[model samples]
Target: MVDIEKKIIEIIKHKPVILKKIYELLQAENKEDRRLIRKTAKKMLSDGIAYKDSKNKYHLVSSKQVVGTIEFTKSGNMAFLSDKNGDEIAITVENSLNAMHKDRVLIEKIGQWRDLPSGRVIRILNNEIERIVGQFQKKKMFGFVIPLNGKINYDFYISPENMNNAKEGEIVEVEILKHKSKNKNPEGKIIKILGKPGDPSIDLPIIITKHGLPNPGEFPKKVMEEALKIPEKISKKEFKGRKDFRDQLIFTIDGDTAKDFDDAVGLKKLNNGNYELGVHIADVSHYVNDNSDLNKEAYKRSTSIYLINTVIPMLPHELSDWICSLVQDEDRLTMSLIMEINKDGDVVKSNIYNGIINSKKRLTYSKANKILENNADENLMEEIGFLKETLESMKELMYIIRENRKRRGSILDIESGEVYFEFDENGYVKDILKRERGISEKIIEEFMIKANETVAEFFDIKGLPFIYRVHENPDGEMLIQLKNYLEILGIKFKIPETMHPKVLQEILEKTKDHPLNESIQKLLVRSMKRAIYSNNNIGHFGLASNSYTHFTSPIRRYPDLIVHKMLKKYIEGKNDLKKQDIEKYSKILPDISESCSKKERVADEAEWDLIDMKKIEYIRKHIGEKYEVFVTGVTKFGLFVEIPEKMINGLIHISELDDYFIYNERDNSLVGDKTKKTYRVGDKIKAVVAKADKLTLQVDFIPYENYIKINKKNTKNYFNKKNKNGNKKTFKKKGKNK
Candidate 1:
């Protein structure tokens, strides 16, 4: 077998283009012979001496040639290779189709169409995880496993003897026993059964597997023991060289369900008439020392995963929830940003320090909102009077600062939505709510922004190596598409070549009262580039600021924690690190940022998926009932409508539209070719629930005739004119009598 593998490697090295035919020939054999050949081929491929073509053809790529990680879709047939240059190349599932997601593979470019290079996976650089979470099933004498994640499209063939204790409909983890060939599914054996389908506990296993994230249960006891050793109470020695702000009336504002409080704010009127606002963030780095068990665990997880009903913290409960948490009345260590701002919200003086703080109050946004509206309880009124006054003063300062940001061309006011969950004691969602933006959220946001900007500016002045939160300008193509979409809606908004944040803000301001404000805002956000962490201080496009960095909430966000460390290092005049060290840090910072961002997105998707499942469950009883909906998306296959009252979305299939016959991509509408009836994105309509699939979390809808009638009557003249001038006029006469 070893000699055969060596022969295969030599053959590929000599004639790489013949890999496809060779593999095919080897596969078209008896079972025992094929197994032997496959083992040899697998070993040879793993050596990285050859490459595969997009067509599944094999060829030899040089040992020093380009290679990258390959991620497979569930189908096990196709894969995408992410190269060192950040370019992803698509590969057919056939030739080297056995490679899984995140498997490093060597590739040799085979051809090109125009400027697009095409390649194939020649050698498997590494194998992905052998274990996967799926559901077990039996069909007569045979058994199979269906993967929980859509990305893992291939079903595993499970032998009866290796079924373990898994029963039909039981969610279980499976270990791959054998690789797939041209005519067979990969063989697997059930290892552990999780729970029955639709069980809430099943969700965590599914989510963990789906995103390829490690299970929290895997945390070592050593790490847990180390985490427990960290002191919960503040000590004099720990507070050495730290400023004391325990006497200040600082407070934390978070959600009702929030356990870990990481940030606190305090405001005071300075003698010079300027406001001295302090943003204090929990200093997790102080206790979770570098290279320690707790630090290692936190670094591995990167960020906490906030699901609908649970928060999977990066640090264990000892640190994330109890010890380092900035709970009210508890003396906690914090990295503080003390800034002096004039009446116009212009920064006059700023300083960063390691400090001890005592939070005076812990407030929820809802309660704060009520109090700010002057509808406060007796005790609340007395306890929160100073904080309320400070909040009002902060609001005034924020408005001025916001205006200044706008004048400077910052891109603010993107329409963003937050999903709120009402959970049962069992950890299941009772209800899902779309949290609306309010003054309370804005107050916190404004302070965080001011703190971040101040820190960035301070680091810039010091000429230090620091991580900055930067957002580059949007891609030219995306901007053009945005402009085109706006033009289609008869909205004249020009996106400059070098666009500023103020331009976006202006557009939002102009369309604030418009019916399509939400739609336009969504488009604007989609067109912008994502913000990332980097050592270089490029300006943030979304904030419309020249320089920005994450300096707030160091306890939860790793980048902010890194920023604090760098700031402290610079403040102490430790200029020992070299240019090479800075460059090395800069290169890895982007990767870390990208990884953390991906994890955040995965968490978001999992949360959405769970909520969608709960939503389907909630609406199950309402099938066939009608609700008012707004068209949120339009595609060739269907129109997506969201129930405005509940924010639940369903698809109105193209076939379900009896009146509208033509799909128009230009205006994003479905039109009746004969009657010229139109249903466009952002247009309000009534839709009846047609079907709901619990397994897929898909909701189907059909138009409500009564609502359509009302819509038609409201825009009678517009529809009449459109009908008279449309191409539908030619088909009108032929279809009317039929």
Candidate 2:
């Protein structure tokens, strides 16, 4: 029988015949011999060493074929071939048994149908993931872990001995031991136990896992010790050959809670009736040299992560907050952009140099705004008398510059807002507010903008290699959609064939005082592409500049530090930057920019997640209570409503809309089929807190028609009456009284 099985296997291996033919060829007079051949063939087929083609022919898979990575979706697996232009092939779970998400696998194109590709995973080239987050479960004798991240759908069956003291209901980091195989679930071992489920601290790990970011581990002892050794004082030798601006009345302006002051500004009326505007940034690169421990740590962080009440700084507090920070009344080394601007705000002359600066005072935006509004304190009023005069002159120059910018088709009127959190002594949020644009913020912004533009232009004229912040124009399809949406609201928006910043700015200005201003501004921002760092100058669309780069805030931004280094090299006449090096930097800049951007997004997500959790807790106490909400976002799934009083937003799912209509994606609305009732984006409505789920951090809202409709009608009447007065003037709409 063994001899017969061996003979049959050999024949099958060498035969290029159909299964029917092979079966016929392997025919034996005795039933025992035939059964043996059949069993062997079945085993070989199951092993994937052989496959049946469309014609039912059995053959060995060719070794030299296509290879690529497999990306797993919620439904199944799709193999992305190595050819840059090749269409990805779909792989069924039966054939993708061993492959995991982002794992490199050898794919053999079995066939193609109507331009769609089909393939099987012949071999898994590489396994991309080593650790994953999951919930641990226990059986009678063994355990199983289910991944929280849906991308890793498979459960890992763990032996009881390998449970590593992790209890049921505990979230943990699991190390993959073996991928999915024929007779077992993917095996894994518990590496580290995260906290109990539903803990607020678990949000950090979840976000980190979702974004594939590194966990915050203890700093290396050597790195920490070296960072501790950084001196607190600026050395005299460090100031050699550098420009000195210590006598300049430079002052730092930031949020009241801000710790690290990276930038300062000084404005004065020059002898020639021009304005001397000095923008100085901390000289971080001077202390953090290349290949040093501090530099390595900064590069690893890439950017700071600011959560609700915590900031994970890129550099340690010793350096970021004290040593490098431009603290008030403290002398610090800095890289300065000194611009001599005429009354028209045109840059007449500019100089970039390393310098020493003393921040004469630390000003908060509130104080500055108060002073600008003529409500300054006695001491502040005295101290800022000359400064206010200088600022008034600078303001005039800025307006001229701004007018010139607008005339040059610049997009300078984009709406932006920051979330304000009022925290108690314990760093818990007492209140949350939306911080909008103010004159003080605008003044600082204008100065910083002028400084950045001047430095960028200088670099361009010098033909130096520096990282520029570039934003490309929006895609045609997005702009068309935006135009159509605006038209639906009776708003006239003309998007050019080649969408430019000026067109966007014009639309924003037109809608600045509209009821849907926030919604429209958000949509406009969404329509534009994200700005990124690059060596080549593509120009900035948001800033409406032909060339722009980060030349301010070197204390926090790595690109600004790099820009400073380049400026220094240029000033020293050492223009030895090779084209290839610049090209390399160009290529590398995008990846770094993407990484930093991802971190920023993660930080935002973490902060929002915590806030959402807190909001859920806050609303739980107010269940059955009503509040005025503005419809901020609309989707087929649900509407997002922002509670203006608390500055918290929650979703009103489609199922909870009380039989209102199907969603209209085109108009961003929901309309009833029978009544023709419509709920549109940016419409203010009163809603009662129906449900607050702490586990999900979800708040469900149900519309309070009786409370909202009355106020809405009154608002409409007031607007109509105001319009009847022949005044096409801007007016603020008040929400309904709760």
Candidate 3:
């Protein structure tokens, strides 16, 4: 109703409306009008937007309100950007938009709207996005491209000549050429024609184009020729001034399908009873020269875009898959972070230096875990006795470090759902399963975290300008709302006067194994602020680390690449950076961080959309099949049920219920008014898939009895989990209507 009121105000602002007469007009404006218009008509009178006339008909108020867009140019420090919706400015300048030009958005600069002195400038602190990408559909006369990005909210009108010879149904990248007015569709032009959407080879390209990804054409001629000239193997000459770690029994651990190994690890027990752990990362900076075309391409991409069955690498195949990859038995260049950890997991000493390494073997998580249990392939273990011993020692150190982090209030082990599909040899959907992580994954994670943290602390102590992964404290208001939400769910908890990581950890510990833990965990994560890149050292509230920066996987992440370059300069004793240089970087870093963050977000959305799209396609086949679902949310219309294993949420519409249901505003549940039966949220129930629409990415479910059922065993339906007390509680009818 609030949304309808807002929409009505926006429409009425243009002209006075005969409320009853405009019913069809309002309905035609949006597809969701059926649900919204009913409440809007009533809300209009209550909100004073409409009044009864002499004839007893409703009339809209003469003075109307609408949101408009604005763009601002800076006059010194204060930056302002306007919205498409008028003079209203909501430019939240992040640290990345500090010195952006008029062409760029002034993202993340917080400003007040009430009243301000003339010319008062504002500094930046956050960011937003620009440009949209979509699919091109040609018409008989003038063509229009439907945007794949929902945020754009409008189709792009493409001129015949501007189609760039793209055929119909091709996934072409369209750039907004002109925005004449808010009412008119923006004119666009085809910048790149990827290919037909359904083609096997075009899958990755379509996702890339839809997200405006920069997968620059097969390395420029010069870059490729240069890459070819670089010798494949690192000789003794190239290892000058670098610590020699080739004989240190180093090994790479990754998934079985992994092609690129950017990181490797080694371990040794020193005589002093301290464990010496070495995290050797591929020296991508050593190969990709700063300001080179290869480097520039990597910078533009910012980070690797990995999707289902496809990976768009930031670096070329020549580097990412070969030269820069720490392949087993091949001598490769590396930047090593060697640390001595005492029995208590405290870092007694550490050093970051360039080095050379030869990976002894590559082990997947499953294989590595088996090796840890001494139940792996015997031939290799027999040949490499030290490898097995070192892995065990590494496992020991991982646990010690993990416990140390937990003691310091670091919240690292938050469980989340993952779904992945398996395809057959012919590319048909073979199976989809929930992916799980084990101790093998954690061992590698523990090592990487240590490396990244140590590198960040080193640069911070040196007072150098670097991009830090900063997670600000959660909003005070948001936490209060979350506390209230939990209380409503019958979980009473107290919020600390001073918010800390331990506060959340304690509440989560209390909620562990509770019936509502899954949803509560997700909501808690939603309440927390998103981690973003910033040049300022505000500390990462999530990790409980005062120093945190991305220093691993330079081949994939731009910030890591930048960190490697800075680290190289300092480590090589070439630290001639001055205050002016630092100031110059201060302005430039904001834009870089903002751009990188936006690019990463774009990639994430594209990946998630593809994942959801396929999942919907998979679920559509199970229509009419009955499955157990847990009620995760309650609405006026229905109960929202979530398939536990798949993490798929679907709505069980109230209309689909056998009995007449009334929405209970008090408990936020659907109540059977006559029968005095209630269907409260968090209640488990059996439901049948009534409908699944890919276009809306929505699944509709019906109560098991109301829907036509099918054999559940054939579909492998997973049952709901039991409570901590090992009780599987079933609701007969919300406990006799409360």
Candidate 4:
């Protein structure tokens, strides 16, 4: 068989010939040889090894060709596409099928001359984007909207009829009409004109509309009216059959700007030497009835969107802020989870109840941290002794809970510090600061996670229908890539006997304090599957839990509201919760989960865009200002630097480097080809802000004129192994949340 296959290939080496010609050329006189030839030809064609075109001639499929999703770089010079089989291929923009970033495409290998194969797009399987955010420019009869995002290389052509009277040079949202052949550009229509791109208030609206996010202005009036009708004051009749915790010293802790507080905490020591910890979440489901206008609106939005300048809430303010918020000194409906925890952080007993509470006080993270860390308030210490003890006891309990969680192999990704923006009276940026998560934030987080776990366990044991938050195990191929990258950073950990969360958590801890910590963590996070809502109990791999669901923050998230309703029904003596309503929801929960997850991602992207725009605007004014920055990445063309104060990254272009430099592929560094000077990853240098482009989110930096190159002795090939595809020195992937 092997001899026949090779002989046949040699016979047709130069060109594809007719099958009749092949049968004659082979001199097959007997039926046996003829049968073997036909069998081989059929096998080759069926397995994609050979194919016959319209002319009825056979040809071998070119090597290294496949179909995958094409991801673009910020500059659009090159593209990489990867499929589920772990195969990756690269192609140049010229070979791209006008495939926008993240679009699926069919590609064929053009050459194998280089170590890595180069491909050309044959067909586009899917164009994932439907619209874009851009600036409109009027033409003679029509117009073009230039995409603000750099990955979108094509400008959308718009006709005058679809312009909607948009002015020239205004930021606008355009809906994509068509994206035809590779030779043609994508066409679109102007749906909304957001004022000037630099306008603080106007840009946000354009982003929201561009992403198709829910808008507060378009909220249903029926839902608004129903929310307003909910009384501010709690009536006596509404408190019946509800546990009243108004006398308890329950209070809320949140950010200083938080208005719609969702969860509150109270703690006390039991006479039996145990502790009773209460986690009370606002009963938003009580006010927003099932299948009502308010409920439907909340389901549509799925999650509240917090942006730089404003919030797009999941529910109207009348319900989220005024009626359901756990405000201080106000009666609010709540669903409380009271756990009696022993000294070892084990729950001895637990109960869930429909309750009412009046918060004693509202504490901000700053003040709460002070009370935990400082013992200087003498006058208030005597009067607020209980408050102090409550906090101290809570801290003790938090330690035990956190320790137990770590033991359970829960993975924590404390990767990046949040860049917080404070605006001036005129809506311009006043200050930018990096806010590290402190103990106060963890106190609330630990308790909420415990409560959610408890609720999920209760439902699971009773065999009830419920919505769960599940994160599947990370992709093995991605993990292998991550492990290779970590080895480059001089970090190491066990890969587990098979695959689990503990080993990843161990690696996460080892990457801290180094300059590459944030980037490494980000890469590891990108390797893992996204956490999502589901009815099937797959168990959360990241949390390392047997059962888990979101049972807190119903005021800001819809799934929590659903959980609240279920809890209420079960606590009211229907423990199994196997009613017709439960069965109906169980059937549709998969679709609901999918829709909510997609919207959550959209909300996240929109929020990030708003922040990125504001950051660029704020940084642009500081052009020519020099600041020290750490070298987070060393690319073929430039060095990527992260500013300490702003926590934002900018590029130090190779052209900006005084001496001409050549990229060193093996070491992930750059060397002055003539001067013998070098720049390595993790080095600190000062550079002036050369440019900050809001439209493209591009920031460039240049070294100070007098700054000298370190030229320090360094290791060789530190970043030697490029990610999976043929070790291209310029292997780069752009976009965020990775």
Q: What is the lDDT of residue 546 in candidate 3?
A: 84
Candidate rank order under lDDT: 4, 1, 2, 3
Quick one: best TM-score, which candidate?
1
lDDT of 4 by residue, 1-738 (tens): 556666667766568876766678888788888888888776555344555555767665555556566877767677876533334567888888678876766678777424556788876656777878888988999999998766678888898899999988888888889985556678898887777766777767767755667665458789888877888888999899889999999999899889899999999999988889999999998898987899998898999998864788988888888889999989999998999988777788999889999998887776677778874377555544457778888888888888878888888655456788888887888778887776778889889989999999988987778889988889875676576556656677446656778887887777677767666665577678888888888899988898999999898888898889888778765555647767776766765776677578778878887887888778866664678887777788889987866877889888667667988765667889778888866567887666676777777876754222221222132223343212213212222211
Q: What ranges in model 2 sit over 4 Å off?
A: 1-218, 379-387, 391-404, 409-415, 422-430, 574-617, 644-647, 663-668, 692-698, 705-738
- The lowest-lDDT stretch of 10 consecutive residues in candidate 4 is 725-734
Q: For candidate 4, what is the lDDT?
A: 0.77
- lDDT scores for all predictions? 0.71, 0.70, 0.69, 0.77
Which residue pairs collide in model 4, if any?
A: none
- Poorest 10 consecutive residues by lDDT, candidate 1: 724-733
User: How well is each residue in 347-434 modelled by candidate 3, as lDDT tens digits?
Assistant: 8899888899989988788777777877767665675555677778889999998887778887865785778887667654456688
What TM-score goes with each of the models?
A: 0.81, 0.74, 0.73, 0.74
Cα deviation of 368, candidate 2, in Å: 2.1
Q: Which numbered prediction scores highest in lDDT against the true structure?
A: 4
Per-residue lDDT over 1-738 for candidate 2, one digit per residue giving the tens place of the 0 to 100 score: 446546655676786566456557777657776677667666555333455555666665454345555776633334334322234576666667577776766677777634557677776656777877777888889899887655565789988878999988688888889887767778999888887764556656655554455555345676778778988898889889789999878888888899999899888887899888888999888888867887777666666666555666777778888989999888898988888888777899888888899998888887777777788888888866656765566567767778867866777776555566665564344566777766767777888878888888876876766678888888665676678678878988886667667787788788989877776776777788877677668898777788888878776677777777667666665534556655655555554555455455455656666666566655655655678888877788778988865767788777555555788767677887777877776678888666665434567776766324434655333222223212222223254322
- What is the per-residue lDDT of model 1 for residues 47-118, given as tens digits with 9 covering 90 to 100? 444555556556665733557667666445566665554466666665455565666777667665344566
